[model samples]
Target chain A: MEIRIGHLYPDLLNLYGDRGNIQCMVKRCQWRGIEASVTEYQLEDPIDFSGLDIILLGGGSDREQAIVCEKLKTIREDFKAYVEDMGVVLAVCGGYQLLGHYYDTDQGRIEGLSLADLYTEQGSPRLISNIIIENEDFEMPFVGFENHGGRTYTGDLKPLGKVLFGCGNNGKDKKEGILYRNIVGTYLHGPLLPKNPHLCDYLLKNALMRKYGQAELSPLEDREEKEANLYIRKRFLERQ
Target chain B: MKVRRLMAVWTAKIISAACRLSGRQGVTLAGKIALKIDPGILRDLSSQVREKIFVVCGTNGKTTTNNLLCSAVESEGKKVICNHTGSNMLSGVAAAFVLSAGISGRLDADYACIEIDEASTLRIFPHFKPDYMILTNLFRDQLDRYGEIDLTMKILSQAMAMAPEMKLILNGDDALSAYLAMESKNDFVTYGITEQVFHDQDSREIREGRFCKKCGAKLEYEFYHYSQLGRYRCPSCGFERPPIEYDAKNISMEHGLSFEVEGRSFHADYRGFYNIYNILAAYAGAREAGFALSRFSQVLESFNPQNGRMEQFSIDGTKIILNLAKNPAGFNQNISAVMEDPSEKDLIIVINDNAQDGTDISWLWDVDFERFLDPSVKSVTVSGIRCQDMRLRMKYVDIPSTLVEDVEKAIKDRIQHGCGNLYVLVNYTALYSTRNILAGMQER
Candidate 1:
């Protein structure tokens, strides 16, 4: 079986090694004897969401984020439909902010896709640190890094996890990310998936199950991933 | 006011001496204490320079370029003040001036060549304006510290506006640096290579300035030397690479580097291609400052790489190379430099997530570690605070690696049993400690 991945604005929204998520996804599938091909959707390219099994939207600089917002606004209806169809989408940092209602910044307000019931406001002294989260759906905790100036509030959507360490969401709610259907949006960008193999496989399994009606994935050796994850989890969680 | 300055200088000197006695470098602590006592310490000391002051700023190569410029100026029979320990922040800049001054809080240097951090320009410029600002190149680095490349540019632009009289010496190959020079409307000179040298096929490189900052249009590159440093032109706005005043031609990388700038042949025993830009920036800055070039070749040949900027050591017939690579672009360049050697070698990578090393270790994935899959790289080992992440990154590329928690042990293990050639790559905070470890082993 094959899985198609759509990477949005690869040229613009690629900050902090964001392409590593695509690499992790592609390599894990290829390791399992499953074919995974990626299609990068540029600023002006036509995005056919129906052909893609998974879609990735990474973070970018403020200037690049504005440019991407203008381009993404044109495809709002198509993206909304894709999200409604239970498409597995992972957005991070600035991309995570773009999936909400609007981001109020020092410069002004920038509109998001409004596909999720969330909003973000620019905050002082950016929330930057190594972050860990605990989710009910996964057996193991997730580990990653977070750096952002926007405080997000998931008004009606369920959070992806609870803040085990570091600041999450607004840093006051003790919540992190927004989970709607199969979509995951968060501010973690240690490419968020390579070290968290369980989370990566979850997205992959969702994509696989939706396409093939079954996802009995044979687990690969995750010793390196587990060690890296545990290294962060043990350091922070133990300290607390 | 004069008494306050004198007290600050004396206290800082005593603190620096105490730090040395205690076996600490005190690279920035002295300056930090001095600034607290007398906030105008930098302004008073820097204004005492007898000749021109040159400031080097950029994401990478700042320390090397600044030190080289200092050497070039010193070769012209002039006394110079410089931060030789790779401390480029505001406090470090202040310390360089303070430590170099006499006990009476007076500076008697003929030239001042200092490397300034790009993000700290706003704070540094208010104290003193440089006669010449050399911008080596701009790339994505330490995103958590400095929000983004555009934000960095904005801060630098504001700093430039504060010092209208300072001229810019820019790297013409970098569109971001060139665009900054143009926007500032300063008298600027560019240095670049006209020919394409690095034929790197890695498409995973994150080119920060692929679009034109002037017109917001995509840039068209004829060929990439490496990571967006090449001949580029914007088809929409007619904005292109400025004419090179210090063009490097007849470039050759075999047996170190050999190149020519404006009919003057120069050679340096440097490893990476990026060093060419560093050397050129120094040469151009010295020339623009009206310094004699007769002793430039001698200066370049005698300048040695210290503090893990490609410093070399030999241990019982085994050769070892140590280098610092803090970001993806820098790491990729270091990898290319390592691959240039065909001899079978063992490699050790030390990654740390300390605040100094940029707490985000995600940039490790952006580096093309897959290139180490070559047969010549006999073995790979990971070490440091974030060795697990490094090991995992290597594993994703199908390169089997040994995980060593301690850096000194990792090096000793390779030197004892592996091939005679070894390469050690480290990040910011790991460089000095790793060098100390290597030095200890070599002495024994």
Candidate 2:
């Protein structure tokens, strides 16, 4: 099967190894004899969701974020429609913040696409640590590193997972990420894919199913990926 | 006032002595204790040195540039007090001064060359006013620790404004450093590599400061030396690289670089294009300090990358090279340097997620490790607190688990397997500990 991944704002909203998610998806698909083509959509670039199978959005520095927020507003309508159609979308740290209604930073409030019924607010003391989340969708816990200042409030959407370790979504909520239909948004950016091959394959399977109505993905050897994931998960869990 | 200064000095000396007696490295401890005793210690000592003081700050090359400048001034028959160690914070700067301050509350030095951490720039300038400050280059370093490059630039601008008389020495080739010149109006003297240096394809992936700092338009690069450090100009708003004053030309970096500065040829003791920039920055700072241009030859010839940076070892006829790579840019440069040698080699990358090492290990994914998958690379072993993370990153690029191993066991096993050429790339917090282990193995 052929998978087309749209990497949104490849220039502006790129930070914290976010491209690794794209790399993980491509490598895993290629390993299973699937052709994965990535198309980078930068600021002001017109994005057509018709041909895209999966969309990946990463974070960036605050300066870059401001520039991206303006450009994201222009594509908010198209992006929201894509999400409403149950298009496979994975938004990370800064990218996740922008998918919400607004991100209230110390400087000012940045208007998000309001794609999901969510919003974020900046406060004192950033929440940063190795995060482990328990989700029923996967056999193993979702493990990743999170470094974000904005606390997100998920409105009318189910949380992606329950926090087993580290601060997720908000420090108070014991919940991590917001899942709207097939959309996944999280602050967990160990690029959120390389270490968690289960999540990587889940997203791939979901994308395949959404596009072709069936996904019986043949699992490749995941010995290395499993060991890496177990190593981080155990490290954080043992500390707590 | 004298009594307070003396108390701080005596406590620092006692702490230094006690630390040495206990076989511990108390480099920054004494400084921290001295500040606790007398917060004004830095101000008093710096006032004594006044215009003779030189402060160096940057994402990379501050240690190298500060050391080189210190050596250059000292070689010119002037006494210098500098933080030779990697302690570049306020306490370290204060400690250097307190340690230098004698019982008479006077520093017995002609000049003071101090390295200031870029984040601590605003805090350092209010206390210690240096007559000259050299910024090597700015890159996105330890994100959690220093926010962003723009924040760092803002801090630097505040620091520059506080020290209005300070002569700013900046890297013109670096768009970020050059952008600093536009932010603040100090007596700015720029230095850059005028000629084309070694080109590495890996740099294209790590281009930072690509957007125009002045206008949000994309920056047009004539050619990159490495990671946005090149001749770049904005097509919009007309912001461009300033004219280089202490320009280095006729560059060659096969073994080590040789470049001409003010019609005089000089050779840097260390290899790498970054080191060449470090040397040029030092050369410019020393000249601005009123040192003769010809006097830098001896210092340049004798200078070496201090500590475990580019330190080599030979254990049982097997050559092991240790280099410090704190960020993606440094790691990529080390990889490029290592890949230059066509001989068979194995890499052991040790990544520590300690407090000093910016506990967030996500930066590993930012490094272009796929470039090292050539036939010359026999194996790639991973180690330290975040070794598995490194291994997972390498795995995505198709490097098998059999090739990647744990640190301690891999070193012994690699040696046992008769691996002759080994390159050990270590990040910050794990540098000294890993070096000691390698040293112990070498002695055995």
Candidate 3:
């Protein structure tokens, strides 16, 4: 099955190796003899949300994030429709904050897409560190890095996981990321998917299941991924 | 005040000596301690400089450019105070001054060539204003420490405003650096390679300066040398590369590097193509400071920055090259330098997630490790704290890698059993430790 991945503002919203998520997804699909293609939708490019199996919105610098927030606002209805259709979407860091209600920064309040009932406020001393999360949906824990000044609150959405290590979403709340339908939005950006093969596969499975009604993906050699994931989990999680 | 300055210098000197006696580099620790003793130590010491002070700032090549500028000034029979170690922070800058000062806290140097960390420029500027600020190039480096490139530019712009009299020596090809020069309105001289040298497709993937800093428009590049450092212009607002005063023409990187800048032929036995900018930066800085360039080539010929920057080592008739590859841009350039060698080579990449190394190891994916799948690459070994992440990065590219937990052991294994030609690429925290390991093994 062919999976068309739509990368929103790949040029603007790329920071902290965010493209690695796209690479991880593409590589995983190719390894399983599945055709995967990535169509990068720039700021001016028209995005056909219906043709996409998976959509990735990565993080960017503050200036780039503001520019992308404006572009994302124009396509809010289309994106909301895509999410309602159960299309797989992975938004990270700044992108995750932009998908919410609004991000209150020192400069002023920047409006978000309001796809989810989430909002973020700028916090002092950025919550930056290696983050591990425990999700009941997966057998293994998710491992990634988190660096953000905005502390997000998942208003009514279910959290992706519990914070096993490091600050997640808001340090006050133990909730890490917002998980609504097939959408996964988080602050963990060690591009968040390469080491966490289970999550990568989960997103791929959701995308494939939506397109062809079945996702019997053959298991690929995940020795490296498993080792990398376990290394972080064992390092941070086992200590706690 | 004199007693306090004297105490700070002597205490720092004693601490530095004690650190050496205890077999520790103590590169920045003494500076940290000295600053604690006297907060005004940097200002007091730097104020005593007999001549001009040059400050080098940028993401990469700061240390090398600063050291080279020091050597270039020293070649003209002038005493130069420089932070030889790659310590570019405020404490390091203080240490450079404190350590260089005599026991009486008196600096007798003619020129002070200090490499100030871009993030620490504002802190460093309050102490002493540099006569010339040499910005080698601006690429995304250690995002955790420096925030974003915009933040860094903002910091630098504020720092430059503090010292309006300071001239700028910038890499013209870097649109980010060039734009900063244009915005600052400083008397700046740019040096850039007008020709396209690097054809690596991977280098083009990780450019941080794709958008125009002025108009927020997509930058139009005529050709990219590597990673946004090329002839670029913006369609909107008419922002473009400044006219290069020191244009490096007829560049050749076959045997080291050979290039001509302003009708003067210069060559260095440097490995990476990026060294041309470093050398050019130093040349432009030295010239701008009114230093004689008669012994410039001689300085370049003799300058071998042995602190893990293309530092060479020999063990048991095997040639080993150690270099620091901290960020994606640096690692990509490091990979290109490695690929330049056609000989069969064993590669050991040590990736640490230390606070200094930008705890986020995600930048590894931005580096094109798939290029390591060449026929000449015999074995690839991953080491350090984030070795598993490095191994996983390699695995996605279908390149099999061996994970060695210990960096020294990884180096030892490759030097003993693998091919005689070895290349060790390391990030910030791993550089010194791995260099020490390589040094110890070489002595054995």
Candidate 4:
């Protein structure tokens, strides 16, 4: 089966090796004998959400974010429609911030796509550290790096996980990321997949299910991925 | 002023001596003590110096470029005071001035070449008016500490506003670096590669400065030498790469680097365009300090970068090329430098997340490790605090992983079984610790 991944604002919103996530998804599917293609959608590119099985949005700098935010406002209707159709979307960091209602900043509030019932406020001293989180869907704690200045309130939506280590979503709450319908928005990006194979598989399964109506993915012996996850989990847990 | 200078000197000396007795390097400690004793020590001591002061800075290559400029100036038979230690902070700059001064706090030198950090520039430039300020290039580094790339530009621009009369030497190829000269009324000279030197297909892998500073339009590159640094022009606005005053023309990376600047051919042991920019910046900077190009070129022949910045060693008959990469630009350049060799070689990438190394490890994803999947690579070994993350990043590239618990053992394992050259790429803290471990092995 062919899986199409639309990488949103690859030129603008790729701050923290954001391309690594797209590459990780592509490679995992390729290893499983499935054809996966990535279509980079930059500014003004037609957002044909129907063709895309998964939409990956990475993070970028404030200047790039401002540019992408302006472009995003123009495609809010199309993006909302795509989300309504249960498209598997994974947005990270700055991308995660843009999926909310508005990103409040010192300069003013920047309008977001509002696909998820969330909002972010720019705060002093950014939250940056190695983070571990636990979700109902995964047995192991999801390990990744989180660096964001915007304090996001998930508001009623099911959170992707609880903050097991480091600050997530907001320092006040233990919750991290948002999992609304098929959309997954988080500040984590160890490319958010290579280390956390379970999460990668979860997204892949969602995408596969959306396309073929079934996703009985044969586990590709995640020996290395498992070892990597175990090592990180132990390191952070030991530090505590 | 003399008495305060003497007080600062004596206090720093005692602290430095105590640190030495305890078997610790007192370079940073001495500076800290000197600054504590007299907050105005750097300013007071620098003001008394009859010699010209040159402040070299950027995200990367500050050490090598600073050292190269110092060596070139020294070759002209002048006493030069430099912070040879890797401490480029405000305290480190103060320590260099305090320690170099006589007992009376009177500096006896013809030149003082100090490397300043980009963030520290705002603090240092306000008090110390440099005769020449050389900015190598700017890249997004240590987001936790330095914030964003634009923030760095803001800091450096504010710092430049203070040094209105200082001759600014900048890398014309870098948009952010060249942008410094935009508002500065100071006399400036630009150094850049006139043409593309490498044929690497993955040239524009990670562009740090893509938008035009003037118009916010996407900048067009004639060809990326690496990242957004190249001969570029903005289609929306007429902003383009300034005409380079000192151009690195014929660059051939055969064995080592051989390039020409203004018809003067110079050879350097350093490889890659980044190092070439360092050498070119130094050449231009040295000339600004009134040193002849011939003398600077002569000194560069014997100048080797210090403390594991492209330092090489041999262990058990295995050739090891070790270097430090604090950010993506440096790391990417080192990767490309290793890829220049088609012969099969074992690779070791060591990463650390120490506070000094910037606790954020997300930048590792920005490095194009997929290029390491070349058939010439025999093995890939990962080590350091974030080795698993490195391994995972490389896994996507389809390269098999060898996670050695100890960095020393990892290098040894590669040397023990490897048949060809071993390229060890380390970041920040790993660079020094791994080098110290392997340096001992090299001696035996």
Report the C-alpha lDDT of model 2 over B292-349, residue by residue, as the tens digit: 9566777777776766677778887779888889888888778877886778988888
lDDT of 3 by residue, B1-444 (tens): 888888889999998999888878875999998898899889888899999999999988888888888889999999999998878899888888899888767888998999888889988899999999999888888888776788899999999999999999999999999889889967889999887775644433788879999989999988898887889999998999988888889999889889998798998887888888889999988888886689888999999877899999999878999999998888888998998888999999999988889878788988888889899999999999988998888888889999998998898788789989999999998998888888888887
Q: All candidates' TM-scores?
A: 0.97, 0.95, 0.97, 0.96
Off by over 4 Å in 3: B199-204
The global Cα lDDT (0 to 1) of model 3 is: 0.88
Model 4: number of clashes? 1
Q: Score the docking of each candidate (DockQ).
A: 0.80, 0.73, 0.83, 0.69
**How are the candidates ranked when ordered by lDDT, highest leading?**
1, 3, 4, 2
Over the stretch A126-172, how does candidate 2's per-residue lDDT look in tens digits?
Answer: 88888989889679888888888889999668988999999999898
Pairwise DockQ winner, candidates 1 and 4:
1
The 10-residue segment with the lowest total lDDT in model 1 chain B: B196-205
Which regions of candidate 4 deviate over 4 angstroms?
A: B1-7, B14-24, B199-204
- The order by descending DockQ is 3, 1, 2, 4
- Better structure of 2 and 3 per lDDT: 3
Q: Per-prediction count of colliding residue pairs?
A: 0, 0, 0, 1
Model 2 misses residue B256 by how many Å?
A: 1.7
Candidate 2: segments with Cα more than 4 A from true spot: B1-4, B21-23, B102-105, B198-204, B401-418, B439-444
User: Model 3's DockQ?
Assistant: 0.83
**First chain TM-score for all predictions:** 0.98, 0.97, 0.97, 0.97
